[model samples]
Target: MDEDYDYFQELRDFLGGTFHQDISSPEQALDEYINEANKECLLFTIRYCDEFLTSNRTKQEKENYIQTNAEIYFPAIGLTPLIWLNNVVEQIKEAVKLK
Candidate 1:
């Protein structure tokens, strides 16, 4: 979990910095970039989880990693991070259901 936390913390910081530089106002940013941001977040989460699942980790570990990182990564876009994170989680769940 520590390793997962550290990896995601670094990813979160990088993405957060990028978003901060790209968007000046949260409202305007949401209006213009929400879809792209949400897509990126969802893709990242899915890819990360998929890769993690291929590793030696258990299913619970993969789930824990996703949940832990969601709190960090989803908010990187600077426009209602928690809400975006929730939306991303919902999207992920829906995708998993289709699989």
Candidate 2:
């Protein structure tokens, strides 16, 4: 979907929150902070990607599903599930580089 929101700004905003109680809350620290519960939720959302690709639903229906699910699970991100998933992937990539 074509969205106008600033991607980096969302990351910045999330990192600014007090979600993590340990470690410095740097963007690079995202991977470390995503505990098991968050990981399970993210994985659950990600598993829908294949369904989104192959389903016979109309484009709008698929988009709506993604938005609804994202809002339910990750309202703080204020982004569609796919977008949030992409952001998570980017965070992982960055973390991997530090290893």
Most accurate candidate by lDDT: 1
Q: List the residue pairs that clash in candidate 1.
A: none
Which tens-of-lDDT digit does each residue in 1-99 have in candidate 2? 124544333333343331333534333354444432354433432334343435587766655654443323345546665565456556544444444
Deviation (Å) of 46 in candidate 1? 7.2
TM-scores for all predictions: 0.29, 0.33
Q: Can you write out model 1's per-residue Cα lDDT over 20-93, one digit (the tens) per residue?
A: 54566534443343344455454555554344445676656645554444334334555344344344445565
- Per-residue error for 30 in candidate 1, Å, reads 15
Residue 28, model 1: lDDT of 47
Using alpha carbons, what is the TM-score of model 2? 0.33
